[model samples]
Target: MKPESDGGSEIKNYLVDKREKSSSRWTRVNKTFTIYDIRLKISGLLEGSDYQFRVTAVNTAGNSQPSEASQYAYCREPTYTPAPPSIPRVIDSTKHSISLQWTRPMYDGGADVVGYVVEVLEEGTEQWYRATQKTLKTNLFVAAGLQSNKKYSFQAAGVNSNGTGEFSEPSVEIEPVEKLSIPDLDLPDDLKKTVCLRAGNTLRLFVNVTGRPAPVLTWRKPGIDLQSRGFIDTTDSYTQLIVEKVHRYDSGKYTIEAENPSDTPGPPGSVRVKDYTKESVVITWDVPSIDGGAPVNNYIIEKREASMKSYKTVTTECRKTLFRISGLEESVHYFFRVLPENIYGIGEPCEIPESVLICEVPSLPQDLHIVDIGKTSAILNWERPLHDGGSRLTGYAH
Candidate 1:
């Protein structure tokens, strides 16, 4: 083949030639034989045409027979349509828009990728619509102007100079919706049970609230405005209504309500004075429903003359709910308050609903005597010199 590569004669240059596969005539591709390397860059070929190439080594000997014809090659354009891209994924959504993203195609069909085309299809419709008329250079796009609660899917195709590529598979179905959590009140069965407390008993109601976004809260008693004495506290987790000294007028259905982003524990129940008399009274009460996370250690019973604000402690270690208080001044009005103690300390006092008046029920009559007596009958007599209490005798049972 040229006597061991040109019989040791330095090769001047290489002649590159090409021929259409349809004919046998050959044509030169270079005006000068200057290529000295094994590789050559071919140019100026009609697209979609098939041809073959051969190389002729030229030296001082003038020429060498053209190398056996090389393999046939298609002379089409180097760049072609891109391949389909990766499946798209939904990134974000709103009532009016949906955002999607995808990776560039695995193959750009021999050309540098230029842009992408996004297409969408609505639920319950067969037609797929182009999201934008102009191609997008980014791999991400947000399809706007979507109807609320409408389900839609999207597909993407790449673009280059050659043309648009095949569309990628459709993305997962999506339904655009404005996010909001309606405020809600969780009412326990205890809240629904009718309360049967006495007039002086405290009324405490606790309610739990929940929502995706925290909700604004409101307490409603419908027709009646709450008394200044009543207290209510609201927090993110709970709502508390505390009517310290509830009266008959306070007996009614209480409702705790709230409103979401889209919309909107306290002390013991009070001391109750009952079955009171001239020298003694029975006081009973319930512990505060919420102890601020502490258990009640004991209850202190306090009493004061209705005319005074200060109170004298009756007992500091009373553990039971009911207590019998004695030595009260007969016919004098008194007010009583009770406080619960825990590890945290003494809590707020729960006072009775109203001032109580010592009862006027009379004491036992004076010494009795028998004025006359017989085997079958006896005469009863008694002196009225003893205290008459505060009220006149209504009658006597004989």
Candidate 2:
């Protein structure tokens, strides 16, 4: 709130200016004191830029002192409501109602998901209707009063304090019926995979089966009973067999006597360039959060000058997460990225936060002094510059 006194004069307007946290210069947010209210919306600021703003009130008496600068803020897009929940599957049903279940969305947008909304599209219609009268706190809901023998497609959306978000992809269409489907076993992707791992690595074997009520599971590997070695976990939808810290003895084909599901590696962590020099930099990164479905086989490195439109691969056979890229030109800005490769394929790439300047040549040599003097030549020595453009000096010029 403005001061009650206002210095006994009417306030005309306020002037706003901003300064980047790393810079000493301040830039005017508004060219003129045209803002008459206390609240103002500043635009045209670059995203991810750190900045602070100060305000000055103008009146007939003249401009009041600028208010203390606001806290440093990182500019970014405003947050919104949660993203859509996973598609709703028909878990159970009857002639008059269908019970649907779904998983939460991977992204909650920005806020906690307070609840979910289910919608249904009837057969031969374009529009959809809300299946649930209220937001459901649980992951399951029953669409009561579903017309018997009518086909319907279902979708689910998430809700948070901000509001509702986009709907999930529609679930498989199903017709309402009293009798349920037949018993069956299904494997995701119909994939019979041979998982490769190093000794001391963890291996997971999972299967999901969809059948009428229940299906029995039997896991074995030729001579040994898997239950005696690898432990098992069973949930309503799937079962997981995990073997931790495997050795050469554990290397063999394993089979799931009875069951059925799903990523690529996420982007790598921040790229380290602290050991950069005028012509080279040692880049390092943390492994991706996910390794698709298998362990990372290798990493790919690529770099591009800021002015270039495409990146050139530096190496496709980097086995480690750290490598030194040299031959970079001095004073040029560069962008480097790394991608992880697993049995599946190469995942998305993670890039340096900003362009890097290979940087200038080494700083000037310090404490130069002539020690030995001769009639024909002189010997000179000096202390090296504190910063060598981040590298050791190959030699020195007289």
Candidate 3:
């Protein structure tokens, strides 16, 4: 008969197979091999029925050395104790691996435990499988080739000279999942503004787009059905709408087209174009037919000396047209124009040729002087005036 261990340890047979030299079959061993209760006093005796008992046939000749016992003797009081291995707290977890640590068993059946075995089972599963490690490990158990998201349960056992110990209670379940990383988008959130027109002759439109692969930028004019406006063109990073000489016609709405596999619906952004006109000679203007812009808020009438480099604001009012102008030098070739303003910004000035100017004194003598003043008959002379109501000045002596 053999003593079987529930935990995994080698089976120990207490019986020595006893076949007399003539017997064909061996005898079965049982526990009833007691010998009159005095057998406990003997030193080299066993309790198993098939265990051989030595007899001495020393009749006068010194007994030959005792025959070798066929089987090992039963222990007088062999003790059995089980110490399950300690299950450790997990150190860390990653997408594909788990780390575990454990301590040595507390009770090794009164003998030094030889080794430990770890078993694992998927969470919520009953089938437990064995692992290959012979000793307790403190580092990560490199279990690769696993499902993306799953939990596994683990336990450990201790083995000693006597037998294996019971399995430890299941360690807190450990789970692993796939790692995810997102790429940066080509555009930012705050860059949603569609229109940009500066004080100079520049117009820009910006849009936002997102995808794994970056997208290309395209410029367009939404008002035009065809793409042939000659405005849309591409540069290094920007889609340029170059109005080489931006004018009133180029001062309408513009669209920015961003294209990728996902941009089929339509373009996402737009900008309004407006050119600035400051100097009186440059002849700045707005679309006369369409006043879509914030109607000119107020205009500033400016004047500069013919030889001077700087101009000064002469008048400002809510009116668009020039109504009244006074105190201007006569026949001085002075320039006059109207500047328009709006919520977006100031538009180009309406030049003088486009509008009429009222000369302070109607084309009259630019200079008058008294020469050789005299009484009624004294000689009088003066520079001839260009035009003065078509009349000559009557003389006065003063």
Candidate 4:
């Protein structure tokens, strides 16, 4: 026992006893003692017997009051080693880092657990390295600066005043991977095509993309552009542009651009008339060179007659590139044009020459009859037709 007062003389001996009453006889447990001595052993006790012990200090000043009785103890060898810590398991991970968690040891060797130690082993190596510089007071730890695509294992151990306990079983292996990247565009091959849309028709363009650190997209037109006034939407892997209506002036090259830190612009897209008849014309086109990393929404078509100075839209929202314009006047010279539209806006126009003509087949002749019949031949007569189809009729064949 330590001296209660610093001014007191050094302790000479200690009086010990195993009784509750102060009047009971006491026994001297230690004869060879020192002033600094604080621990003692009382032997010769029977196993499974209840016993309470107290001690008193004998200093030059006087014998000090006895200490409170210690709790009963069953005679047995004391254990100072702790059980192994619970298994360590991974909780989170990244390309170069891993986090782990574990439970404390099941048996603490009669002492409170003070901290834990963590260790890791790389794949293909037999050596284990400490993950933390100091013991961790909590059950969780994050190990960082690991190599990507490599496997690793981990283990944990509990610590107390007695020392570190045995390590837990090794954790299952794990591997880290690189983050996702921006989309890759298959360049010149994709640029060769152009997108075409009919006037007054809807257009939808889709752009498919892939990348790490995913890319951002924007749609653009080369020259003075039509207002988008349309919806543009995007997804994890693709983007889309929608045009409700299209016009002739909407014709031109459209560009779709993608960027993350790097930029990839697609080739220019064009629209044109495919075929035309007396009353209607068909238009078709390819997709834009670059989709601006987004899909195209729709296309637009427009037309103008030879007499009109300005072009009029035939369709506002053409879904497809091919379209047929009907209800044209016969014998009238006209012009047909197309435009490609995306969510960005309408592009430049692809127009045909203004010399296209609307013509129809001739009508049948009237009052045709057989005037006379002969044994070998018959004579036929007919009146001139009401309509000449804007051209003189050649002689008819019987």
Estimate TM-scores for all models: 0.31, 0.33, 0.29, 0.33
Q: Write down the worst ten-residue block by lDDT for model 4.
A: 261-270
lDDT of 1 by residue, 277-367 (tens): 7899999887676554334657889999999988999999997678999999887889988888765578878888899888755678788
Order of all candidates by lDDT, from best down to worst?
2, 1, 4, 3
Note the clash tally of each candidate: 4, 2, 1, 57
Collision pairs in model 3: 365-385
Off by over 4 Å in 2: 1-56, 62-77, 179-398
Candidates, ranked, TM-score: 2, 4, 1, 3
Residue-pair clash count for candidate 3: 1
lDDT of 2 by residue, 1-398 (tens): 57456787898888899999889998988795498777888888889899999988888999888888989998877778877778888877765678889999888887788898888999899999988688889889888887753679999988987899889999888876443334354555533666788999988876776553344567778777778888988655677889989888888877765421114567888888768667888899987776654456689999999999899999999977799998999878999999998665889999999998886568889999999999999988889898777545678875
Worst 10 contiguous positions by lDDT, candidate 1 = 259-268
Q: Score candidate 1 by lDDT.
A: 0.79
**Between candidates 3 and 4, the TM-score winner:** 4
Mark the 10 consecutive residues where model 3 has the least summed lDDT: 263-272
* Better structure of 1 and 4 per lDDT: 1
Error of 4 at 123 (Å): 1.2
